[model samples]
Target: MKKLCSVMAGCAVLAMLPLTAFAYPIDVQKQLNGLSIDYNSYDTDNDIASIQVNNYGSTDAICRVVFNNGPESPRTRTIEVPAGKHKNATAKFTRTIIKMRINLTCTPK
Candidate 1:
């Protein structure tokens, strides 16, 4: 019975492995070509903060965003913008901060 319980638990853990997104391989830089992606604007009003990207090209765009503030450690993300559409990547701080700088580059993979 103990052996059966351990086997069942192991199987259950393996069964749920597919729920993780990092389980597979991903290539980032090669995926950013043939599209228009830019940091259009940013707004940090109230408790909310977001970075917006616009894609004007016929194809979708993927970009890597690096956000930095003097006091806090820098953060980054891989953002996807649909063709002719835009997207916003967001972040939150424990308390209100002064300023945040946004930088973006093409995504590969």
Candidate 2:
């Protein structure tokens, strides 16, 4: 009876482990025109924050990117790159924002 009770307690503890020790990956890709913009969250203690943008298209593209902190204001930058290349850009923010806006323009190969 003692061994059976111990085994049941051990099984209960193992079942709770999955609830606390679980991780989920996020996918942040949206398509526009002929380009697929892939974005991911980044963390930094410095004053500037950088985002990785990948061009998943067949042709060269130019990205008109905008970073907003809230309803207050936003910063913009343009990045020109060929296909299968990744670009990095930094945006200085006074406060954290809810979402980011990424606009792209595809150029002929």
Candidate 3:
């Protein structure tokens, strides 16, 4: 019984390892001009955030991405995506992020 209890405790500790990671919620606001635009947002790290923009329209596109973290100045990035291509925009913040907001705007080129 003593050995069983020790093994159970070890298992519990291992199981809890994955729970130590902090994952925050991400919110996105987008505006696209009659084009098919898809985006994915990620809280890549404690101070880093990224967004992936996918353009599925027949025409190339110019995209503007804005990343906002609480109490931090917003970061802006511009990218050009060809038809059926994808692009990534990333920003790093000075402080750890509790929540992330992304604004995406795309226009045909």
Candidate 4:
């Protein structure tokens, strides 16, 4: 019974490993032309990151999102956000990301 309990505890610890992982930091730089644009950045995975753009203005807008990871090429994603709508942009890097830097530029479409 003691051996079984020890095995169960080990299994529990292994299962909790995924939950112990914390997200990396994300930095966002934005240039919105007087539009009500809001954005949220996320560290999706070890080698992936994403941004969610929310447009609360009355006009449609075009947005460009760039994701940069250390020692890897920057990834750029261009998206259109309709009025009162939102969109998501994601990028995957070749290596595990320690920190993410994002540049966001939006203009009326």
Candidate 5:
């Protein structure tokens, strides 16, 4: 019985781990990290929250965004932006753009 309980506990912990992991292209990640990002503008047309991500660097870049509006108010998820010199993205919530975090995890090319 003790062995079974230990195994169950291990399984419970593993189940609690996040299973939603997105793997973007490696070459794109390298390109994105090499460039710098510039905040352009935000748009909220037709109840959709969208923002522009511009790469001010000399090369292209890849980036991901995470929206954090409020606790239990808007459940946002991680979304990858377009792989290019510049792109636009829409978040789950648009009421407050400050809560959004842009993660630029790019490797130097």
Candidate 6:
């Protein structure tokens, strides 16, 4: 009876392990679109901005970010991340245009 109970308990623990180990899916779309930039105080000589994105998914994801109304030409880049986690990227420019906006796209495999 004791051995049987021990074996059953072990099996139960093993089943629960997979459930807890599962990782959430990365939602890059929401992070990219939800980004907000504040330009309340305007200065002609100096302008700075930053953006961050977090990835939560079962697998790694690639992110492509684009910045519009930046001081320089528009920029795009891709990043890779692992499962059950998140990563962030930043963009900076000296020039500030009215209603600055950033667009991001994430792809997971």
Best by lDDT: 4
Which stretches in model 6 have alpha-carbon errors above 4 Å?
1-46
TM value for model 4: 0.83
Worst 10 residues of 3 by lDDT: 15-24
Cα lDDT of model 1 by residue, 37-88, tens digit: 6554444443335667778777766777766654777678788777788888
Candidate 4, 1-109: lDDT as tens digits: 9999999999999988876485898999999989999998888888999999999999999999989987988999999999999999999988989999999999999
How would you order the candidates by TM-score, starting with the best? 3, 4, 1, 2, 6, 5
Model 1 whole-model lDDT (C-alpha atoms): 0.61
Tens digits of per-residue lDDT for model 6, 1-109: 9999999999999888744322222112234332222111222222333345455545566667665553477656566656555555554565544444556666664
Enumerate clash totals for all models, in the order shown.
Answer: 9, 0, 0, 0, 2, 4
Candidate 5 pairs with clashing backbones:
32-61, 32-62
TM-score of 5: 0.41
Comparison by lDDT, 2 against 5, better one: 2
- What's the candidate order when arranged by decreasing lDDT? 4, 3, 1, 2, 6, 5
TM-score of each: 0.56, 0.52, 0.88, 0.83, 0.41, 0.48
Q: What Cα-based lDDT does every candidate model obtain?
A: 0.61, 0.57, 0.92, 0.94, 0.46, 0.49
RMSD per candidate (Å) reads 12.9, 6.6, 1.9, 2.6, 13.0, 17.3
Clash tally for model 6: 4
Instruction: Candidate 4: list runs displaced more than 4 Å.
Output: 1-22
Alpha-carbon deviation at 55 in model 3, angstroms? 0.7
